[model samples]
Target chain A: MTAVSIDSAPKTAARRRERLASGRTYISAALIFIWCLIPFYWMIVTAFRDVGYTFDSTPFFTHVTWDNFNTVFSESLGNHFGRNLLNSLFVAGVTTVVALLFGVFAAYALSRLEFRFKFLVLGFVLGASMFPGVALVTPLFQLFTNIGWYGTYQALIIPNISFVLPLTVYTLTSFFREMPWELEESARIDGCTQGQAFRKVIMPLAAPAVFTTAILAFIASWNEFLIASQLSNDQTKTVTVAIAYFAGAQAHQEPYTAVMAAGTVVTIPLVILVLIFQRKIVAGLTAGAVK
Target chain B: MSTLAQPKRAPETPSPKTKKVQKEVGQDRAATSQGRWAFWLISPALVLLAVVIVYPVVNAIIMAFQKDQGLDPVTKVFVQGGPAGFDNFVHWLAQQCGSAACAPGTLGAQFWSAVGTTFFFTVVTVVLETVLGFWMAVIMARTFRGRSALRAAVLVPWAIPTAVTAKLWFFIFAFDGIANKLFGTAILWTGSEWPARWAIIISDVWKTTPFMALLILAGLQIIPAEVYEAAKVDGASAWQRFTQITLPLVKPALMVAVLFRVLDALRMYDLPAIMTQGSNGTTTLSILVVDQIRQGFNSAAALSTITFLIIFLVAFIFVRFLGANAVASATPKTTKGQEK
Candidate 1:
């Protein structure tokens, strides 16, 4: 008891010393917070500015307004913000569903199956992603053209899935591997079919990782710009291409309150999505990473 | 069904015939067990990947050959020998691809140089961000108040869409804009090449370092606290503890952070596309491809080929040589490599 007390004496003193040394942490944290907020603050300020305010230094304070939002939602864009929002939602939803469904299976295989050339398969997926998406536009353009798939949602969706597949596969695989081996062993000994056991137990348990990957795939697909531009000519433009170009040349010229409004419009949903999945994403990515 | 669901408790002293029958059934089930689990777990991702990745990649490789210009919607029919073979390669090399005859400075070697620029952008940004992020993660890990808020705030840049990020930088860095007003009388924020790219590089580093830091923080959590205590008790300095105690344990995490960032930086398109549009020397591989496709250049296919190669190389090398520990460590927590 006396020895334990002596140990505690030093530990308590050490903790006090450590706490004193950490005084700088609060200051650094505050600075980081301010730095992070500035960009978002700039974006919000620009979104509320009047037409010519953005060009001058006075834009920061000349009075914030709804004019940009008013223009974006009501008068400016050919397609209303609501409709573009729909387009973004639908695309994101589809991408999430497909990516998750496939991702789960690939993960299971990598986690469990001792299939031939499994490592090579992993490499192939990684390698495919390495293809600079922009440079492949030529081949994608040609491929889509020959098949008459150009300017279609399939054009965009198919390529998006392909690009994300390798990372998603690896991501989920790592997730599956992290799962307890004991559960699988117990299920096998209990005489449940392997498929039934996985369905009844494993899939349910992996839900968080699944949801995380789904959100990521959805966000990437939703925020995507280039593929949307090439795949859609006029009929099927996405929110990104819609807001960046077709909606306004004022991205450079004339009244950017509308453009700023459009920019704000374009960013909100994904931000919300990030918040929703932030913790899960952190869990999923870390699980996949920490082997 | 409920009876079937009951656990098959081992019979203590069963009749010989009943025992034989039970044992046969159990053996039969076990025989197919692994196979069933294997297929059940493996097929969904494998099939989807094959369809999405395997098919398109194979098809795209085939498409890179041939002058498929006849297939152009603007044109009525197919042109067979339409500069299909090495012509796209030659034209890309000669800088004749998007020269005024095509689209002026966006295609061919200009495009390849953009690929080179993309590599430059990715390497510089990844290196800087990784170092900064590691330091930040270390700082944040120390006990402090307002740390949660700071962590949340750091993510603010990442949460904002890239297009929005471009605008924020544009606001700060544009000629006659707040950047110049606040800092000096005259500066080229966008008109010149290096300054324009530097603006983007700075914004990217700001936007992404949080991601790296958060990831490293997650990795940092894995090291045993006892180890740090022991090191400290041994009179280790801050630098030694970081290098000796912290770094080796956190290396896998660091690699995962770096690999993810490198792959991401290589695929960078929207940032450059929105900001500089390959104007000046700010062009990256992605910008070049977009420009070529938009211009109807035959080399657009060739550009995609080269760009894909760069990203693929980075992904492969990072995953291959960097060790799986880094990838596995960072997977579910930091980068969203997780699947449901």
Candidate 2:
């Protein structure tokens, strides 16, 4: 009993020392968490507060109301803001669907099949992904204007698809490569044709990846600002562009409340997506960047 | 169903006549068809890519050499003039270097400043992001209660639109905003030079640090725990273990992540444009290109060509010096002969 107690006393002392070391780690983690979350919290706080209370010296949430949100929907400018939100949704949605459609086949081929100059092709796609959107802006502006596609949704959507397609291919290819080869082989042996095996067996397995890719593609297209700013007029302006040009009820006052409310509106969908599919999003994000 | 089932039985009970034919051509046919199928499957993407990306890029190259006559009034298409033979390029260089063709205090001068700003932004933000991201990644990689929640919180900023982030930051740095209250100084962030630049940097760091951390975390995850344990057994300190083991192992992923960020940073447009409208000496290469597009098309094309070349060169260097497959680590090399 004396020996065991002696051993226990030393063990307890060591644990205490270890805990002291770990204490810093926890504190830093908490600080990181707070740093990450404060901006978002600020946005939400600003969204609920009245326009009059936006510039108070005190930085606490007080007299919170849905009035700013109401203002975003009620006023004439709010209608425009509302339309911009719709435009953003449509543009982002179409970009996601179209890119994924093109990406799946290419990703599948790159990941699974052997062909001539395969690395070269993959290299080319990778290069294109890094193609500066700004570099393309002038040429696209000229082309779109010439084709009478300027100030149109298709104008914005087309450019977005081209830029984001490479990302989709890279991310999805990595995902497709991770799928077991035998799944397809067994499906083939079990009286399934190559096409049938892919569609029925492989695709179901790839659904989660596809969904992750979709969310990423969607978020990217949603976040597009430079091209959307150039391509769209009032009717087709995206939420990002709209937010940039957002005005108050009066010209002199900056519509901080309405803008915050609108900002919150735009942010909510993305937050929801991240919360629901955080795991998949992380996987999708790290897929190409890390092994 | 019967047709499919019939094929399965036929293959099993292959006739003698067919067996000879199968042996002669079946393997060759399957190989050729597989290649053909692969080509066919990938062609749609290749075609779409060529039409959209390749065509425009080629067009821009050509346009850079042509005279910058504004768009036609009737057709709205850019009207091309006689080949100027490096006139635009020379003019652009003059703006940056103060040549005869282009003078100081002009658009070209502005372009030079933007380039400098871009260089500054890229270096500063990339450094901050890498360091902070590494710290955040270390935190994220730790297994604990609510680790998943922490990761989600970190990604919230990444998911938010850049423009929204810009606006959010703009408000947060306003005269009466939280930044002033927190710092106890009412500096005009957006209306000034260094403060404005800092605002952009702060927002960018907040927005993209998650991406850096996520990429680094992936690298960290691949590092087996046994290496650390082995080092511990050898009486290595935490600092020593980290420097020797973690840093070396994490280099490739870090290289890739930094390369990606550097490229993206060089093309920065949205944050500065939305936050400060490229005012107060915060103009970047992209905003400059867009600005020049308003003044003259050919000049804008020239500037864009320069931007593309810089990006291309950086990519080329990365690929040439770094192992070409560094970024391709995402996919296993499953093909027959393409293995590194």
lDDT of 1 at B280: 75
What lDDT would each prediction earn against the true structure?
Answer: 0.67, 0.84
The best candidate in terms of lDDT: 2
- lDDT tens per residue, model 1, B1-340: 1112222543757899988787667655543554465566556666766676656556555555645454433454565544366656556656553222335543554755776788899889999998888878887776666666566566667766676677667767777667788777577777788888888899899888888888888889888888877887788998999899888888887887788788788878877777777677888777766776755545566656666776666666666776633433423333223322
> lDDT per residue, candidate 2, B235-259, as tens digits?
8998999999999999888888988
First chain TM-score for all predictions: 0.83, 0.94
For model 2, what is the C-alpha lDDT against the true structure?
0.84
Per residue, candidate 1 scores C-alpha lDDT tens digits across A158-221 of 7777666655776677766677756765776688765777787787888776767766667667
Docking quality category of candidate 2 according to DockQ thresholds: medium
Residue range A1-291, candidate 2, lDDT tens digits:
122455787888977987875786788788889988898888888998978888764556887899888777765654577788889899999999989999999898888775666777787788788889877888999988899998898999988988789899999998887777688877877879878988999999999999899999999999999999988887899989988888777787778878889899999989998989999999999887776
